[model samples]
Target: MHATPLTFIGASVSWGKLRSAVTTWQPLGVVSTISVRAPFLNTIRLSSSIHHTEETDVAAIDLDEANLILDILHRFQEELGAISDAGDRLKQSRSPEVDEYRRRLVNVKGELKNAAKSGTLDGVKRPQTELERCFYGPAVQHAAAHFRLRTDAPPSMWLSGLYDPAGDVSYYTHGLRKLVDEGQII
Candidate 1:
């Protein structure tokens, strides 16, 4: 039996030979280990352990082991003509038409902001009405019909779309870049 040693603060440790050492390791919560072997690559092996309380789960994954298993699996799947990859999944989830609509909404918002800055009531009203008609009206109606989300959903909910992984990655990347630029990250 291969033993993976784990330690807990305040837990008694009799650090010595395995034969003589006493292990008082008790389940802090539900404890489980999952071992995975890749069929395509006999060299690939992975073991993941998860410990959890009623509230939270703590996972311990060896990056090297996990990577080896994933690489093998990916290659096997590719060879076996497995289903679509991540990019395909992303494309399937995001409709180009929906993205176009979102882009138009963003343009409408910009127009509305410009109108407001002009400080003329008529200038604001026309663009505001156009925005409501062209963007929010159809969006709200669609959400209500399909997802049953309220027409009056919060601004944040309206601003955010169904699935935009690229957008999320871009947002995070921009934040990281900003941090680097400000010398907050090294």
Candidate 2:
């Protein structure tokens, strides 16, 4: 009997393998692989057929895979697309490249969070509020307080939705759940 590979391997590894398969192998310049598992893409393909230079006729995608793609797209929309208007300052500018960078950051955060939740990373949650989206919440006060005590930084700096440069911020970014585990930051 034939077997599906994913039956033995976990979803996290499946995602990684998919990433590697797509990234490591560079295809021809004219070749493109658009994995549009979303049902709405069929509608879009139909509506925008006039603008296309080449015909795109591929086998119908599996519904389960389509649902997964739809879910991830929804998550991305929730996490980034809505907030794209006011953006992540990657290199002091909000360009398309910066937006792609932020999207990749979110993807890494999601994948790592999924893979390590049972052991390595714990007590981690998705960013809910706008401030929490850009700035680490627990680290916010620590960095702000460090700036306050050391530099005598004014309260307005923190109040104005700005980030202060502090070393402890790394601790918050990398090992946030550990902070909660050790009672370091609540």
Top TM-score hit: 2
Which window of 10 residues has the lowest lDDT sum in candidate 1? 13-22
Q: Against the true structure, what is each candidate's TM-score?
A: 0.20, 0.21
Off by over 4 Å in 1: 1-33, 41-43, 56-69, 81-186
Compose the digit string of candidate 1's lDDT tens values, residues 27-111. Answer: 6442322222222222221222333233322222223322232233233324222111222333434546445434433432332
Model 2 C-alpha lDDT per residue in residues 91-185, reported as the tens digit of each score: 35545765454454344334323322321111133222221322234343344344332122222222222233234344444453343345543
- Local accuracy by lDDT, each model: 0.29, 0.29
**Model 2: residues >4 Å from true position, as ranges?**
1-16, 19-89, 120-186
Per-residue error for 93 in candidate 1, Å, reads: 41
TM-score of 1: 0.20
